[model samples]
Target: MPSSLMLSFLFFLLSLSACSLKTQTTEPEKISHINKENYMIPGINHGLIQSPINILSNEKHETKNHQITLHFQDEIKAVENLGHTVQLDFSKGSSISSDGINYEFKQMHFHTPSEHLIDGMTFPMEMHIVNYAPPATKNGIPHYLVIAVLFKMGNENEFISEFLTLIPKQSNNTVKLEKGRVKLHDLFHDDLSNEMKNYYHYRGSLTTPPYTETVNWFVLKHIIEASPEQIRAINDIEGDNARHIQTIYGRHID
Candidate 1:
């Protein structure tokens, strides 16, 4: 059966038992990284267009089919060590335009040993730059556009080094940064627009709790280089928090 038909059937069942359905409001004690049955999320175990699936480059050659108009400027957003990974919460209109919708940057976090694979291969680290598009609902969830950049071990990435400048040893802690001190350009190549255009587009969900299936994923083809020590430091803090890869569910990877 097609994934859409499968999802429709699953949700139809969910609706039948909606009154008795119970959702987990707290994190599970022992979550299964592979079998999402342990995730405790409502739609994860059944959501068709789930994320973190391997992108087989040979499956489709559509990197030339799209373009990116990312207008990101350096904003010294508050940097924090969220126990999961280091992150930057964006607010000052750092945005990307697609299909006439401007999805402004929300926050960016990391995964040691990338979640998405390129032709069955994994990178040392992956950065997820999440953005939110307008027409954002007050009650309903808004659409998201996530830009993924994978990092290979090599020379120290001075751009990523900015995050290392202030590492809060403990969780629930944040470090104050001077305005415009943390440059966004350090995160990407000089020719940001060109590199971003050559990317794999797909439909996926959040890699974490609630695992909402409302994201428009764009995994960049170009790989960024970061030093081994940088990668190791990140792992020491986060400790392999990546969820096991989800099934492709017959979804197209364009």
Candidate 2:
């Protein structure tokens, strides 16, 4: 071959090698950016008081001047099978008054492998009893009082058993229950006041998207019990939906 032709061939090979190397190096960075974008919104998912934080059991908490009263009806209307979680909707008229602010019972949902950690310990399941108070103003931030109950694998939990089989098989489906078919009182053995006496209280954001930072979290100190089979059944439907723990940011846990 002529020298000029040989030189041209060598240049072409070099150019191809460089292009391959560039793709190999840059592809991962591009993919990583997309993954981050999908997982987190710039300002929405981040905040100083984000949820699912590790609750240090030994940490000292300041006593706050607050009073809480529960006017619960324990009337669950329906169960919904969202793709990401199993949720039970509550009937209206049940409300909790905390510091003169009233928050009504809305719904309860579950997360597998838990979200919040107690002394860095992860439970098999976690349930959130979400209550909400509408904002006073048009654009004000809404208020939330979330009661979190962590569950360990032990004897079967009556609360979970009530609606476990009743959950709709398909995602986004809801099954309306007969009156008194499923009761939250059964979970506490009809002793909700005694069961709810002790808790770890804090302020945090919702674990899911639009993680509004106005949540008043009351994590029940008493860990509940559920059978391994029951936990597996719920986990199978929801998969691993627990969010990663966020920084505590020196927040108070009372």
Candidate 3:
């Protein structure tokens, strides 16, 4: 459902150079000292395709060409409270791919108030499934790919609540999910195989420290839901964990 304004905004994002997006600062350094107004990302942030950029719902940008596959047959390993947010890591975990490149799922995390915006619309929560692909293993730095699934307030997600209860409330705390008890795909829509095609594609960076522009972002158009109690539990642990949206820098959204 794209309008003229949405299309205009899409082009405008890709029209600017990377240098303008840099907001370098030397203020508070830790996540505890961080706020949306001040993200002490320790790196050169200028002149790159940074995230979380707004994803427009325009007809021209729609596609049936992307063939995305999600593979997560691994069991849940452990969950950690990394001060800023809660993260779920898998054991010898999953892989998602398209064409020939394989993206290995590293871990999954959450952000309240969402990160990447859709047509300037911010949702209640966002889940990022972090995956890495090694392309020509040079210096051992693998290519990063993140699949972002946004959430609205509605019926409770069984998959999410399945593990949400195991998350530690204190920062730097960690917990272990019962071995061989969980699956990654369960957190997604029941019809994910067919629904994942309707997504927004773009080249962007990590929303946290060392904000590198080494990511192939796949943001699904379909949103999942979290009940009121589930939302309260997440917020109670890590309130307002989202990073402010970044400038698109004129990079075309596929």
TM-score of each model, in listed order: 0.78, 0.81, 0.76
Which digits, one per residue and each the tens of the lDDT, describe model 2 over residues 1-254?
Answer: 99999999999999999998876654322433333334555655555667888999877356564588889888999999999999999999999878778999999999999999999999999999999999989998789999999999999888788889989989999999888989988776746656666888887889998887778888889888999999999999989999999876556677
The positional error of residue 90 in candidate 3, measured at the CA in angstroms, is 1.5
Which sections of candidate 2 miss by over 4 Å?
1-45, 63-65
Q: What number of clashing residue pairs does each candidate have, in the order they appear?
A: 0, 0, 5
- Candidate 1 clashing pairs? none
Ordered from best to worst TM-score, the candidate numbers read: 2, 1, 3
Using lDDT as the measure, what is the rank order of every candidate, best first? 2, 1, 3
Candidate 3 lDDT over 1-254, as tens digits, reads 47998998877886664435443322112222232323634555433457898777772354536567877576678888887787898777578787567888789898988998888999989989888887575575467878799999999888877788788877898898787655655666455556567678776778987676567788888888889788778877888989898865455566
Task: Tell me the lDDT of model 1 at 162.
Answer: 81
Shift of residue 50 alpha carbon in model 2, Å: 0.3
Assess the local accuracy of residue 180 in candidate 3 as a C-alpha lDDT between 0 and 100: 60
lDDT for each candidate structure: 0.76, 0.85, 0.74
Tell me the lDDT of candidate 1: 0.76
